[model samples]
Target: MNRVDLLTRSDALARPASIAVDDVSVTYPNGFTAVRDASFELGPGTICALVGVNGSGKSTIFKAIMGFVTPSAGQVRLCGLPVDKAVSQNIVAYVPQSEDVDWNFPVLVEDVVMMGRYGHMNLFRIPSRKDRRKVDEALERVNMSAYRTRQIGELSGGQKKRVFLARALAQEGRIILLDEPFTGIDVTTESAIIDLLRELRDAGHLILVSTHNLGSVPDFCDQVVLLNRTVLAAGPTATTFTQENLERTFGGVLRNFELSGHALHEDDDARSLNVITDDERPLVFYGVKKGKKKPARDKAK
Candidate 1:
């Protein structure tokens, strides 16, 4: 048999990109501003974690980048082209929050993985043999090949997450946007996913994942973008994940228990602590508790 050499398909990867958000802002019909004047650029081969509170526009920004939500003012560009243009070329893949999905939709693992390839297939064309091969490769990469025939709803939470990640892999997207990919996953699966993410970064892929797990940012991400309806801090993890920045982004200490050991004093320092109103409960009770005064003239009776 004549030996045939197989070449890796790096050309299918997305072009080198500097994902730029030029003062982008998103506003809803009700006049609620989700993101305002947010500007940041993420380059190739790096992973960034978007951290913020519930209503802090993390998902809004992701939607803007994916063209689902249009920015009221600025622009979002990938590799020097508009986001929609980049998406049309199949250079972007988004893994939505698992909670947003209806797991009981009755879809098979491989079938869901195939959805990623639909972007590349012509409207009337069926999935080609190459598409099947890509699907197999993606499932294997996430170690979910054994469950390819299983129902997505039957799998564990981590397995479900892996399935979506496999879909992104099958797309061969250059820019991967993961929304809370690690939420509610097992420790083992979280580690596996983090390892896979690192490998992707090493392979020159750009990844931005929205996560509330602040501890893992330093270990698995190259950059951190702290958001509170806008870009509060964006840069290297070490410099950006400081206590002060986190407090500023998250609105003071994340836990009320951190306020322990501080007695309420009438000093200016105590007044500063009062600014943290979002704490679950008061750290220390202030003022004297009023009680019924006993009869002063009881001896007269």
Candidate 2:
């Protein structure tokens, strides 16, 4: 190869990748189109949210990224590599929703987390000392060390979620995809999970979380990709997550409320209150009159 060509290739490799989907389209054999012209890109040191309603092709997009299903058009790339190559190299780790797992399966919690190490194991799939240590550290990080020997089916809903997260940690993948991680967990557990995700993001791990909980999106995610068969919006949360964009994405699915003046039981400062919710959690904004102040967001959701 010429010197110029070699230099160009080296420069590309030197740059860290941001997961990317370029004009991806996924059509099923049944003549149903799952995703269309959808695209988004976010690099490491970011926690992004993939927000959309059920049947909006979230799962299909995820399948495409994981190489479970190939997109009829376009492609998915992770860490500067194709999806298949990334998966094979264990550059990606997935924590599936509870519904996708068979909780009744006869497996201990530690054993389940240890499965994450299979990619790093030898052909025999036996756990080495390093693998065992990774599993133990993962469990401890998720505060599930005491439940390591317990059956997978015997834990609480939140605890089960933590175990899966532990498995992802053990895998030590740079890209983590979590599907509805907060669906059934309590507030405290959800907070803990978000904390862990933030730590991962600060450590240069890329995280993509698919969730319907709009209230929590702004808390941790700085970037967002709104999907509905195709991408409605993809950018920083501050701009892309506005009420107008969300209304376009959710349609009639969100409940919006606006209260002003006497309705708020206030002394009539003309400040208004706005609430947008999907019933799970709501985003609330308190208004300000004149130029005295800008609107303030309450984090109750």
Which predicted model would earn the best TM-score? 2
Model 1: per-residue lDDT, tens digit, 191-278?
8999988888877778999977665666788988999999999998756765567678876436422221235454434321211223
TM-scores, all candidates, are 0.82, 0.90
Quote model 2's TM-score: 0.90
Model 1: lDDT equals 0.78
Clashing pairs in 2: none
Write the residue-wise lDDT of candidate 2 on 120-174 in tens digits: 9989999988789888888888899999999999999999999999999888777
- Pull out the clashing pairs in model 1: none
Q: Best candidate, lDDT-wise?
A: 2
Model 1 residue runs over 4 Å out of place are 1-8, 11-14, 256-301
Worst 10 residues of 1 by lDDT: 292-301
Give the Cα error of residue 247 in candidate 1, in Å: 0.8
lDDT of each candidate versus the true structure = 0.78, 0.85
Each candidate's number of clashing pairs is 0, 0
